[model samples]
Target: MTLPGGDGPILTCEGIGLAFGRVQALLNMSFDVRRGEILSIIGPNGAGKTSVVNTITGFYRPQQGTIRFNGQDITGLPPHRVAKAGVARTFQNTELFAGLTVLDNLLAARHIFLRSNILSCAIYLGLAEREDIRARQVVEDIIDLLEMEAIRKQEVGTLPYGQRKRVELGRALALEPDLILLDEPTVGMNLEEKEDMVRFILDVSEEKGTTIVLVEHDMDIVMDISDRIVVFDFGVKIAEGPPAEIKKDERVIRAYLGEG
Candidate 1:
């Protein structure tokens, strides 16, 4: 993966700091997520990995820092506003609608683009019906891409963990985001599921040209799929490099082992 030079990164963070009461969650962290590249943020627990994602997604605002996406200063924007800026995210735990079908879950993401008024939308008439059909076609394409055809009509809660994860991923993909943030996408998966998830993630980046900011703990998955990595410890960035160099970093090893 050849990174673009001096063109400005797809996402840039500088001097990011966040706190709740006296406990500081993040401090002076900076990094760049290159366009069309998979950048993984790794760290031991309590190292503020999720804080970074929250800050980026506008779930939490940093006291200090400037966050730029596609060269726009988006610091302290709200989550929905951030999402409208072409940022999409999936939770660490599956946040699927327990009673909704898989297809309905994906359709929900597509609903934002409805161009018709409420009464027309309620009746599903004229443009509203056409938009519904269009949205379903896009959702169908996503179902095909994510291989959710067989279970598309099944209730999401009835699916197993790995499959629910796929639905969550598909939901994010449904939004057709420019930059996607995934938090521990393969955390609770078996080996086969993990491999499948990795393949899908890579496909999304390469095939769709979507930039990804991933937070994953599986070292082998991170090392294998990530183009670059930023290692965090105690809310501070300790190392930033390719997988090979990161593997040899003493600070990273120490942080992983809970050592000094």
Candidate 2:
């Protein structure tokens, strides 16, 4: 899938550094995410993979480094502003409104696109009504895309873990983001559920042409779905390449296991 913009890096991180007191979470991290490509970030625990996503999405501010998205400097932008700039993210932990229905949770993500004033919304007239209808239509399409029709009306807190993960994904997609960061999207899933999630992720990239930055621990899934893999160790990038090249990297082997 070709995006309107030329084949340039959709997101670029330059010299990113983050520290919590004395522990440095990320150190001089840099990477590029090409438009419409699936880039997977893999690392052992404490390798700072999630730290990178958090910094990019504005959940955490880096002490140093500049982040660019769509050629604009987004460094230190708040989460909502970054989202407004066409970035959406699903957390390593599900962040859905527990008491809300799947549909309502998805609708909440559409708030960023709402253009109606309080008066128009209260009256439910004109642009307000039209925008509400459009939002619902978008949510419905996402529900169908994620195969959540049966549980659309169910409260998220009552759903199974795997299904809740799907709902979180649906909520992110509801924003119609140009770039989506998925954090351990298939974690805690059975084989069947993992397969389903993988198919849905691929569908989003191939059909919607959305660029993806995926953080996953499942090596098999990462190698199978990623166009390129970035490996991190001790808060620094150890290797970056295609799946085949990453699979054979000695540094990656040593990071995951011990030197033999």
- On lDDT, the candidate that comes out on top is 2
Over the stretch 166-190, how does candidate 1's per-residue lDDT look in tens digits?
Answer: 9999998888888999999998899
Best by TM-score: 2
lDDT of 1 at 255: 83
> How many clashes (backbone N, Cα, C below 3 Å) per candidate?
0, 0
TM-score of 2: 0.96
TM-score of model 1 vs. true structure = 0.95
For residue 26, model 2's alpha carbon misses the true position, in angstroms, by: 0.5
Candidate 2's C-alpha runs over 4 A off are 3-6, 257-260
* lDDT, model 1, position 70: 89
For each candidate, what is the lDDT?
A: 0.89, 0.93
Q: List the residue pairs that clash in candidate 2.
A: none
For model 1, name the residue pairs that clash: none
Worst 10 residues of 1 by lDDT: 1-10
